[model samples]
Target: MTDIETRIEQIAQVIGQFDDAQVPRNIRTSSKEAVEQWLLNKNKEMDLRLGMTASIMDEIFNDSNLPIHFGPMCLQVQTVLETLLNEVRGS
Candidate 1:
């Protein structure tokens, strides 16, 4: 797969880890939607998908009920998405 597609799959895997029952239901549900609805939506442009995913990750990072540990994970995912976005835009 291409670099962009590989990064997306990695992001999806990281999000999948948060799907555990340990996390709040809302966070889990939102993460799932971010992956399934936005990240994996081939109809949308890659840049658009990355932007939307980053937005969702930002929301998750700010969630009151989010575990402290998840904050860094969210940031990492957002950073990767942003980097990919920059590359996509610069090309």
Candidate 2:
């Protein structure tokens, strides 16, 4: 895989952490959908995919039902995604 694809995979792995049963159903489902629909959707441009995924991560972070600990984790993933997006755009 290319560096960008590898970074996206890493972000998806981080998002996967929210898939546990302990997380709210909607949050878990949304996280999964973000990875499947945004991050892994190869049909989209890499920068567009990263931007969309970051947007979804931001929404997931803002969700009231999200666990407190997950907020920072989501932010971290979003930050990484945004950074990757910027790099992709720069190239």
Candidate 3:
């Protein structure tokens, strides 16, 4: 897979591992925005770095106070990325 494709998949996998109830409200919202921005820009290096940072932050901090729909938003972003990857591969 290409670099863009790899980053997309990596972000998707990271997002998939998140537990909605454990994520902070701000992080949830920002994660969705980050995914959307990554989708639009597809800056492989930057996107990969952002995804890795988010994953690290989430692992270090697990907040359950504020509720957010981060899981669903992530799944949506993942689906879009997967679709785009498939299209790029002509599959």
lDDT of 1 by residue, 1-91 (tens): 8988988899899988889877899999999999999998999998989899899999999999999988898899999989989999999
**C-alpha lDDT values of all predictions:** 0.91, 0.89, 0.52
How does candidate 1 score on lDDT?
Answer: 0.91
Ranking by TM-score: 1, 2, 3
Native RMSD of candidate 3 (Å)? 8.6
**Which regions in candidate 2 have their CA more than 4 angstroms from the true location?**
none
What is the Cα-based lDDT of residue 22 in candidate 2? 78
Q: What does each candidate score in C-alpha RMSD?
A: 0.8, 0.8, 8.6
lDDT tens readout by residue for model 2, 14-85:
899999877999999989999999899999888878888888888888889998988889989988998898
- Residue-level error in angstroms, candidate 2, position 51: 0.9
lDDT of 2 at 50: 88
What does candidate 1 score on TM? 0.95
**Of models 1 and 3, which has the larger lDDT?**
1
Residue-wise C-alpha lDDT for candidate 3, range 19-87, written one tens digit per residue: 365766566665555556543345555435444444533533444443455545544554555455456
